[model samples]
Target: MDASSGNSAFNNSVAPLEGFDKDMLSSTLSQTQALLEHFNISDIEKILNMSSRTVSVMTQCYCSGTLREILLSYKSVHGYFSLVVCVFGTLANVLNVAVLTRKEMASAPINRLLTALAIADMLVMLEYVPYACYAYLVLPGEINMPYNWAVFVLFHCHFTQVLHTISIGLTLVLAVWRYIAIRFPQRSHILCSDRRCNVAIGIGYILPLIVCIPSYFTFKIQATVVFENDEMIVLHHVGLSRMAKEDDELLYYVNFWIYGIIIKLLPCVVLTVISCWLIKALYKANRRKQALKGYTNCNSASLLPSEKRAVSKSDRRTDRTTKMLVAVLLLFLITEFPQGILSLLSVILGRCFFRTCYYLFGEIMDILALLNGAINFILYCSMSRQFRTTFALLFKPRMLAKWSTPASQTDVQTTYV
Candidate 1:
């Protein structure tokens, strides 16, 4: 071969390698820039370690190679799951409202409050489906969804926020009512009347509306421009994120106390404390009843059988309802505490503290909170024999008719307690 031909071949090979190196370097710089823009970090090594661990788990469980893909998959699955909960929750709560408002049940104050709660739960479930769809299906795509739909979904936040407040307030009222009944039984007759329950329900709706005025302003939809596919697109998002980004210290502090403490933490603590007391009262009452029955052998003349039976049955019924409600309270706290903690931390430390992980965790926490409403009817049915019978009769009349003789009417008493 000629020297000239050999030299040309070497130059061609070296030229291609130089182009490849430039391409690689450019890609690396762009990726680094994007990472820095998204994450504020003093320690790149710590972020890298956290990313490595998160990526490994994401890859192993979801078979996704990128965090974007992992998040999309996560949102998609949970979004559809949330829709299912919305449908089922709506149906269950509708049934709850129907059964609890019936003449047989509506005479009692507790049933009236539960009926209101069912209405609140139903509204909450209905509101969530659109929000989840917007976040997962619309936000990720960024261009496919119509602008009108995006605006409507974003605006739905206000209504959902009101329902959220009402739901929490109603649960708190239930805990307080049960506490009053167990702690001060004599006052319950006057304090827990239908008039008082109606007043409380009115307060539950109005008070939440009043307290959430600031939240209505804080959580409004925001419009901003973004470059996608080298074209500018306008996007709408919840104002909370923008507020967090702007580092509005006063708003963050307000959110930390209002959303974190009033809406979440206070209710959780109240529920826990009241539930403990109710359980203790039940145990003591049971012990006293047992003692009475045992001592009746020595003082059978002093204690009337009718009085003994009435007191024992009344105590048992109260205990059963209290136990069921305690279960509801515990479930609410369990599902919601993560979100509460995240809200507080996000406010105290700023959104950059946990980066993407915080947002992802927040999404999961939202689904869990929705699940609390979805499963409440199941808890009621499982705990209350009257509720189960009413539910069976309402939904499965022919099935219930096969076994539910006229004699069963005597057995299935009302769920007044």
Candidate 2:
């Protein structure tokens, strides 16, 4: 087939040259040719002949012929690693949803958001399990079966994006709600009410589903014929969509601004700013608590026993909840901020950056996100006494009885966050 015909066959895959100026494309190709001069010219030409897109050219030239090998190596390692993590994460998130939704825990508005976050995370892990098995564990030669794995691949791409985007949006809402609670405790009930929280969570899911509609059209399946071992075989794979191929500006906008900015970088930046503000609020609250403690010590005779106890308990609970939430937000920042920066860099530096760095490191980013999804269970168990108590009461009644005192049980019964 000619170059244009071959390109038509795979219109749903990544096509890096769709939006570039002809002169820029020529300069990029020259640079790519010069970079690959050490390799066999015939071999490079043969690969380019298969798909003469910018992605193909850059993979060969910018990656120095190592991208495929690196992908194979990481796929083997992360396939098993990711499977284990996803399974553990899936189960952990299930437990999180269960525990967070219990009557004892459900009263808190924050727990409701946590429950939503856990559900979204669990779906992410569950969806990844089969993908890891098929993409990573299966032998390469056996991958070209009659089954339409490409469709599932397309579904996985959009499915994960939607769920993760929901997770990010919910997290932002969670942070904002916490900040309002901390900053305006008296009006928190009206501001962060259960009805409002549920509405926010609904928007979190709906907005991402809508924003990602454009992404679903960016890829499609294409079948191509090849001769191997003197036999003609048809191989099906994902390619750029017809719209993506025909509209360079749309492709660039979707990949760079929508994926990088709207999906990744914008939320991450907002989360970081909110986290800083939370930390400052926590510091101020701590100072106020210390000052109140000193004043209480000086005026011990003036205050009633009930009032003093109430004041102390309220202060402790608020401080603990704020600190725990800060930890959760920080974990999110640590895992997602690097990805945002890398995504931005990929767009800014063009296809070479994507092929040389971003694509090669994609698996690492996936594993990081999986870890983030999984590790929240550990955080809640470690940081929240109330969560531990509820979990024990539900799953280990005997242990709960063994460990509990009346005062502790009373404390645990009340909503913490």
Candidate 3:
């Protein structure tokens, strides 16, 4: 019954009927009537391809009432695929949280952020579940949502912009924590402890809303017409607020540029620099340890059979966590790189040829973002010894007795399995 958790069947069945108004709705209804008349989904696609302004106008005037609205919305196999992806991502996130929220889980500053992120991803999943269900059942022309183009754009895309901004920022927060832990291990306890870490996450989530509020007030979206000859598609323009005219489209692109540089590129640089420093320091420490061993055979070609022993799984995972963060960053760059380029192109190049590609391109990035959330559990298990032990105790309380083994005796990664 918690509002934060499940997506009930009742909500799904009645959502279309709940929000419609006697005078406030008609857009989808009209489309549905037209769709029923045509009985062909291709017609809806062709209509969808038209300008945002055209679609807005067409929907605004759609005759009120009835079902079987736009068939094109749910008719595609792609829509089905999107729904499945969203469902899988949501369920994975839920499982991840359930695994982590146990009473026995060790409370660390680092784990607090992990918990916060899991909660955020949970919300992300919650948002997408309804979206997926809508895609499955409510075609664009059939979806009974009202047609206030201004309100719709403000509510959905703007909100997503805020979340996207937060997502990028959280990654950097983790990167900074990693950098500090590795490069300045002496100070790690003070800077990365539970209290400070919780505050850092609290502030990180808060800052996004404060920064993005201007966009909410200054931005306005309405259906606009883009015509080349007789072909026109309804376009959504993010411009100045109601009755205001400003070229903030450039600002939107700039916002993205700022986000990319500050959140993604800068953290990547900081982490890379810190990681290299850690490697050099570790090398020096290893050299000192060898020197103290009185085994100073600098010129000797050595074959130590002891060094070839297979590493314990926990050590393997700890090292792998460092590498994984870097690798995931690279993967993120690869996946999002195209979207950023094309997004800039949409604003700077102003090419009509590329506009239609935006949604398709963006959904690709969304999938990567979703994937990013999905893999974080593996990252935690690799990086944090505490997470592995606690995760084990979640589903197996009997294992709690086994965890009492002295640190030297414990096999961290093996405990999880």
Candidate RMSDs in order:
13.7, 7.5, 10.7
**Ranking of models by lDDT:** 2, 1, 3
Please write out the lDDT profile of model 3 over residues 115-164, one tens digit for every residue: 66666665665565555454334533452333353243345444555555
Question: Predictions ranked by TM-score, top down?
Answer: 2, 1, 3
Which candidate ranks first by lDDT, i.e. highest? Answer: 2
For candidate 3, which ten residues in a row score worst on lDDT? 1-10
lDDT, each prediction: 0.60, 0.69, 0.47
- Candidate 2 regions exceeding 4 Å error are 1-74, 139-147, 398-403
TM-score of each: 0.75, 0.83, 0.61
| Candidate 1 segments exceeding 4 Å error | 1-73, 137-146, 226-232, 240-249, 297-308, 396-407, 411-415
**Cα lDDT of model 2 by residue, 98-190, tens digit:** 899988789888999999999999998898898778665552325243336767766677778888888889889988998899778899999
